[model samples]
Target: MKISDNCYVEIHFTLNNEDNEVVDSSLGGEPLPYIHGMKNIIPGLEQALEGRVAGDKFSVTIKPELGYGERDEDKVSIIDAESFAGFDQIEEGLLCQIEGEDGSPQLVTITHIDEEEGEVTIDANHPFAGQILNFSVEVMQVRSATEAELRDGLTG
Candidate 1:
């Protein structure tokens, strides 16, 4: 069947960056499965897969906005190290959760650390932000979604 909203899709995909570096791929593993219209994948990819059926193979280039989105300078900020007092380790490239202004938990990556200055630079932007992405995809299977799968927005 053709892929459409609420359908279950299995695809083998290789995602690459502008430098042609493979960012992710399912070629060495099992095909990834997801509910077609539940935002399980990036917007550009999901749109490209629409109406495609099993055995379709294609490549798509997705701009930053349709991928991880443009990076916002405001999302990179320096805060007092005391904010993370309880944590034993405070180093660059560390992923941590912090309470946002809205009181919701937000994931942030530690970009820099100044032990003497007692400050930490945190970036809330996605790691792939501001970059174009290329995707090579092959549709392996397409089937009607089971009621449970649709309700859970996933497949077994």
Candidate 2:
């Protein structure tokens, strides 16, 4: 059956960045399963998989807006190093979670650290933001989702 909303779909896919580096892949592993049209995957990929059936193979290129979205300068900020009091070590490239405006944990990566100034620059943007993404995907299976699966928005 063709993939559609509420359907259980399985696919094997390799995700690459503009640098032609493999960011993620399901090759040599079990096919990833998700509920079609449930936002289980990126918008570009899910849209591309629409109407596809098992055995379908295709490559799609997604722009930043459709993937992780363009990077926002406002999302990068420098804060006092004392904010991370509990952490023993504070270094560049360290990833940590902070409370966001909505009271949810937001992941931020340490881009720069000034030991002398006691300041840290953290970027909240997604790592892939502002980059093009390429996906090579093969539909492995498509089937009607069970009632429980539909309710949970997952595949079993």
Write candidate 1's Cα lDDT for 35-94 as tens digits: 998999889899999999999999999999888899999999999999999998878999
List the global CA lDDT of all models.
0.93, 0.92
What is the C-alpha RMSD, rounded to one decimal, of candidate 2?
2.0
Could you give the C-alpha RMSD of every candidate to the true structure, in order shown? 2.0, 2.0
lDDT per residue for candidate 2 within 2-81, as digits (tens), equals 99898999999999988899999999999999999788888998999999999999999999888989999999999999
Best by lDDT: 1
Candidate 2, overall lDDT?
0.92
The parts of candidate 1 lying over 4 Å away from their true place are: 86-88
